[model samples]
Target: MVIPILMEGKSKYLSSLLVIILLAASSLAVHAQEKPRIFVSTDIGGTDPDDFQSMIHLLMYADRFKIEGLVSTSFQTGRKQNILDMIDLYEKDLPKLKKHSKGFPDPASLRNICKQGAIAWAPYKGFRKSTEGSEWLISCAKKSVTQPLWVLVWGGIEDVAQALHDAPEIKKNIRVYWVGGPNKKWGVNAYDYIAENHPDLWMIECNASYRGWFMESESPKDITAEAYYPNYIKGRGEMGKDFIHYYKGHIKMGDTPSLAYLMHGDPEDPQGQSWGGSFTPITRSSKTIFNRNSTVADTVATYGVIEWRFNGPKINVPSDSTVFTLSIGGQHWPGYYISEGTYAVRYSPKQIEVGEYVTISSITELNGQKGTYVSKAPWPGKPEPNDFKLEQHWYGDKPDQELFLGQQQGAKTVSKHRKAFLMDWAKRWEWLE
Candidate 1:
């Protein structure tokens, strides 16, 4: 009887222990599965061949992302078919890619996710009608998931604009990383609408360095036709050949940085160096409000505990009737109104939480003014500075005017991190290990 009692007690204890272990593992698995959920809208098989090149890099690392949608957006159209062609090649090489690492979604699964978007914009408009692309984006963005959907706009942002127009609420569910520059030129109207209306949406405008993926900047050796692609990517496999074939046996992977940015571990911190080159916040300009400019000067990188000081010409207004506060999405900084001309701003509630977006607003009934401001990450308590001094990031030896726009030179300036990635990527194609 004593032995039986002891055995029963031990069994119960082991069962509880097993349950705890399993639950712990289950939580880890959930966490491991939490790659950034991504939706890609590309204008491949269109005006530029770079989208196809970007698709190659994206498909090679498909296992790393929760790819929710492959959209064929505006340009010369036929984007969906191009995506299918790439997936078809991926199917042939699926086994090798899986052997390298697990979680390569079945080719058919990727195919199922591919959908058609608007073939043509509604003649000089941001978004006129919804297509399969817009609806699918809405579904993915609104999924009852904790993370926001990362929409990568490799070409025209028509689908995203259309989705926002159709379901304005989905903006809360999505973050955008657009290769703006030339793409912006194409979709200026849409870009303008999204910028003016969706002030709260987190965005990175890579017009500055996206060109660095293949052009100049941080690392150009990675994509040079003679030095890199021919030797590394050209003869590796069907996919390598496809990457080469996309642009006449060379490489044009300018769009890959957007996807690369997501793969660099911390998708939440855009300020960090990742697969995508680093970017900064868009300056307070009449044209750009929601976007982050890529140039060094126009960006807000990082800083410690400090107070922001703003000064403008004092205008005639009610003295006590005025309220000065930084407001955003219902959250406001408890402004300590200094005077009519100058306002000193600090993190609200004593500690400014990282990734918080707020708007600096001065309102006095008849007159009003506002601008967006994001708090820097937390810092150890340091002696407070007299006032907040805004600083611009310097991109290597780039010039002042060139630094802020980060256009051609700016993109190239930040290519170092990505060049290393391509070097490994080429080797991976050869080894598949």
Candidate 2:
């Protein structure tokens, strides 16, 4: 009788243990499913070396989200090999990372998803021939998942723009976070295409908000850009060693705010406070420069998209495929051949209160033709909708909003969360050690 009683007690204990184990496993599966799906389009090896720093930071935090793709955008200098090289370093450090976090993705999986994007910026219509990178982005967005794919564009938005051009339906399945300031200036044509065509798509055009990553006010000395590296990241691990190679090791991860947006807070609400800066819906406006030359009296709003149209000698080049060059403020900008002899180029002025002269020397009839225009403060009035006008989209804080540290337009929204995010990153850096 005593032996039977003991056996029954042991059976009950085993059943309770099994139920606890099963419950724990179920909890973990749910957590994994809740991770945001991410696709990154970066110009890692392009003119800016800061991309390398952002890539390293991304790899270290890979386990936090479902990393769907890594597409390199700059064909002139950046390549998929640049991303693969970082994966190699991650592979070397995988063992140590795995010791701390089981969710670290396999290096092989990451390499497989790394693809080369557009070899050049988009033509006049916003998309050229689709590349392997754009196709991969489409495939990821078309997946049957319930969550929207979060596209973090670290460099040119050409691929995302092209992917949308090819598969407009995918817009419903993806959300875009673009680090557009100088990047916007470079890829203005592609940016304009999406703004005009896909106004309803959910996107955060973070022009100056991303600047908050490195630029902060009243932050602790240890967490400042110069001090944080030596204090938390220097001599820590393989990632730490590789990080110093970019931007002289000072933290200029302008692209990192995209990741921070997903890391903490509700990504669904761009207006809500998060480690990434808050944003407001953008009011749309534009200016058109017609066939004639402009005098200094003609003015455009700073950051407002401007369309330059020139009626010149007709060439036999393919429609929407031909490229022309416009020299404005000593910078060469690409112009596209529209129907017939008309050529168009879209530009956004970055400087205010400065005179910009536009000249196109590529076309014979358009040669020696010069126009002068001055950029004033950004337009404050509500947009008057027109066929050529930009549609509504989300952007950094408005020009008139109160800011922290008197930072740039939307910078304070991001700078306000600096301490919380930096400290969180510090904890992750310790894992490398």
Tens-place lDDT per residue, model 2, 197-263, is 8877788877667777888577899998888899999988888888888876888888999999998
Expressed as tens digits, the lDDT of each residue in 206-301 for candidate 1 is 654665666543446546655676667756767776666666766667788888877664666666666677655532212212222112122222
Q: What is the C-alpha lDDT of each candidate?
A: 0.63, 0.80
What's the CA RMSD of model 2 in angstroms? 6.5
Candidate 2 lowest-lDDT run of ten: 379-388
Worst 10 residues of 1 by lDDT: 390-399
Residue 124 miss distance in model 2 (angstroms): 0.6
State model 1's lDDT: 0.63
TM-score of each: 0.65, 0.87
The numbered model that scores best in lDDT is 2
